[model samples]
Target: MSDFVLTTPVVLTIFNRAHLAKRVFEEIRRAKPTKLYVIADGPRPNHPYDKERCLAARAVVEAVDWDCQVFKNYSDDNLGCGRRTASGLDWVFSMEEQAIIFDDDCLPHQTLFRFYQEMLDRYRGDDRIVSISGNNYRFSGQRLHYSYHFSRFPHLWGWATWRDVWQRYYDFKINLWPEIRDNNWLTDIFGLVQAEAGPSSEVFKTICRDEDIRYWSRKFNIIHKEMWNTWDYQFFFMCFLQNGLAVLPNVNLVSNIGFGDEATHTCSVTELANVPTEPMTFPVLHPPFMIADAFADAYMQLIFNRSC
Candidate 1:
């Protein structure tokens, strides 16, 4: 029997996009998860829709009608980006063995439930495999088949991971510069490109800088030695160091929905609206390719050149 089920709690972190957050809520309802953990932070002062956003976010919970348990960690005072997000994540992983986490702007494909379930079951015992994520940017020659790919980047829009894997996660390092020095193994770990944030990284880091020092800088510290990445570029490094793999779907199973002005990050408004949402299958094809250190350096050069 498979340990996979569609009834697990889907954790959502919301901070003011009432409208888009509702869409995410409805999608979760369609899945009919057994439990739902909502961590909604209070809006920052001077921001528009301060009251409306909170009310709209709360309405999502009230609209739901089922045998669902909602656990809320609402902030009376705004904890900004760092404390609010990092603390909420700390609370969510405190309970379940695995979970499907999403921000307010992300919309899920109907099949995301099964995809997370199967990935959870497949890599349950593998400490090497830290997370199962949605949204792969490079689909040109990529297959719609189930296979593991490496990532050092963080793809927070939609992703899944085990609590055990998260237990090793310590999000606060104040300064990553020293960790770089302490860890001799990090020479190939964080190259110049991995040190800075690019298109998506910059957008998010800007929002988080006010609350947390900066997500990219924080992540650079985390992987300063060798840690799992759920961040944009950190995903690649995370997989490379562990020699882990990611399961990719045959079709584009997920899409990015955070391209609006209300979005804290990803407000560029790209043409990703046309991507199809298909459920991925299990028994994925494990790619033989491993992300080598040389490749990491080359990628860093390209990313740095393009961004600079």
Candidate 2:
């Protein structure tokens, strides 16, 4: 592979997963990025290893092998999931016009760096393209378009976006609860409600409903919410409300390797290894598509309940 320069900076949001955190840091180091934003979650009071893991995670970033600008947000107290992530992203947006955001669990292919560099430049001014994601799960069905497609979901695995879009984010489901319930937005956003919702659904949706920042995102009329999280189902809902689009690649550029039993969300036992490790080319085009209404319900019954 060849050296790739970033057109936009990269931001990494991490908690206390020291082992996976080390892998993420190493990937970035090998890619030789110019700038890196590290959002390290604070330790929980009375939690024995939380602080130690957080510090270990920080140490990995500090040991980046290349000449790079690193911004650290080592919180003094645990902010939990909502605040830690929301605040970390807020800080990243404040620093750069655009950034490729990552959570520690994700491991990028060697060429993902180059792919982002090219796509960020191509779609920077295009309001329709809200993000440049490292993961694309729809590669098999769709022929490769531009390495992404126009969707309503945010792929949290490893993704990129501009400050202009992030600035409009607010905790809509909370601050504007009346509007959300009145509009019946959650059902529409997530498609159909699941029969046996997973623990994370309640937690995730509760945050969406109660969190202040999320309410703001709903109210501000943000154009798109692109991410690599399996929660893309809900993301599709939020983005759909805004009438936004997502760019999905025909090739599976990104993969979720968080299937181990120790994982917070995905703890599947059946191992899926020996996958291809090549970066799909960019400028890939997407075909026409339709949103699956009951997709969320089926996913909950199939994936979340039995596995996670």
Candidate 3:
């Protein structure tokens, strides 16, 4: 892996967790990306120690020892998760055409960088492919013969995307939700006639409705508010609207360490907390057809619900 240096730029999003940021930064140091973009949100006004903690987290990024060009986008006012991450990524794509993104707590395996680079190059011009994800929640002993599979779900624990796809997110147009919902656009996207005839019809319907009958509904609504401001969800909506697919690894590559007392969204210790990571083989074997794996996605939803 030493010979394969990661040439893609990395965009890292961080808040106030300096300890988790340090742990994630160590992995980034190992990859040694050519350019590092650090996006840090400002501390909340109410928390007395938030300013100090936010500064500490930013300091972790300053410890880059390798020869790399570093860029920083620090916010002066707390923008919360929705605005902070969305605006930060907007800044990133404005400068970079494509980049691998990591949250402060998403610790990736060494091969994760390589995987993103490879997939990004392979599908750079393919508009049908929107993003490359580093998560595989299929812990039920299901395995793919190929290196990765296609899905509509854009898992952002650790992921990569291009500017073209990211531009589709329109935060101000959230009021059009009533129009979109009333038009039954989801049925068209999922091809409900066909999906309903399939074995996983119910699962497909649930995904199309954005109704995770599990535990994420309340949390998602709280963060999203109007449902268009949240960065990752907006990205997912873009992919679905474009009939796009996201590349998902056959094995888990990111271990989320943010679920704890300090986390904003991930405050509970669930099955996804600090999940283990594994190396991915080079020269990936692509799936024959670009289609969402329904069974795998259903299983993923189940696991997420259980965690919540």
Predicted structure with the largest TM-score when compared to the true one: 3
Q: Comparing candidate 2 with candidate 3, which one achieves the higher lDDT?
A: 3
Residue-level lDDT tens digits of model 2 in 1-308: 55346546777777788788787778877777788888877888888988878787777777876788888887888776546766777788887888877778777786677667666766677666666665444323443233445444455567777777666643322334457656766554544343456766542332222332244335333322322222233333345556555444444455565567656555654423223445666444434553421332233233223332
Model 1: lDDT of residue 298 = 38
- Consecutive 10-residue window with the lowest summed lDDT within model 2: 223-232
lDDT value for candidate 3? 0.81
RMSD of 3: 4.6
RMSD values for the candidates in order, in angstroms, are: 9.7, 9.8, 4.6
Task: List candidate 3 segments past 4 Å from native.
Answer: 169-175, 187-191, 194-229, 304-308
Native-to-model Cα distance after best TM-score fit, residue 216 in candidate 2, in Å: 18
Per-residue lDDT tens digits of candidate 3, residues 1-308?
76898889999999999999999999999999999999999999889999999999999998999999999999999988878998888899888889999999999999999999999999998978889999886666555699999887889998999887776643533444445456765556543442355675543443343445324434334434664345666665556667788899999999998998898778888877888999999888888888788778767766665654
Per-residue error for 197 in candidate 2, Å, reads 38
Residue 159 C-alpha lDDT in model 3: 96
Better of 1 and 3 by TM-score: 3
All candidates in order of lDDT, best leading: 3, 1, 2
Pairs of residues clashing in candidate 3: none
**lDDT value, residue 124 of candidate 3:** 94
Q: Give the CA lDDT, 0 to 100, for residue 62 in model 3.
A: 89
What number of clashing residue pairs does each candidate have, in the order they appear?
A: 25, 37, 0
- Reference-based TM-score of each model: 0.72, 0.71, 0.87
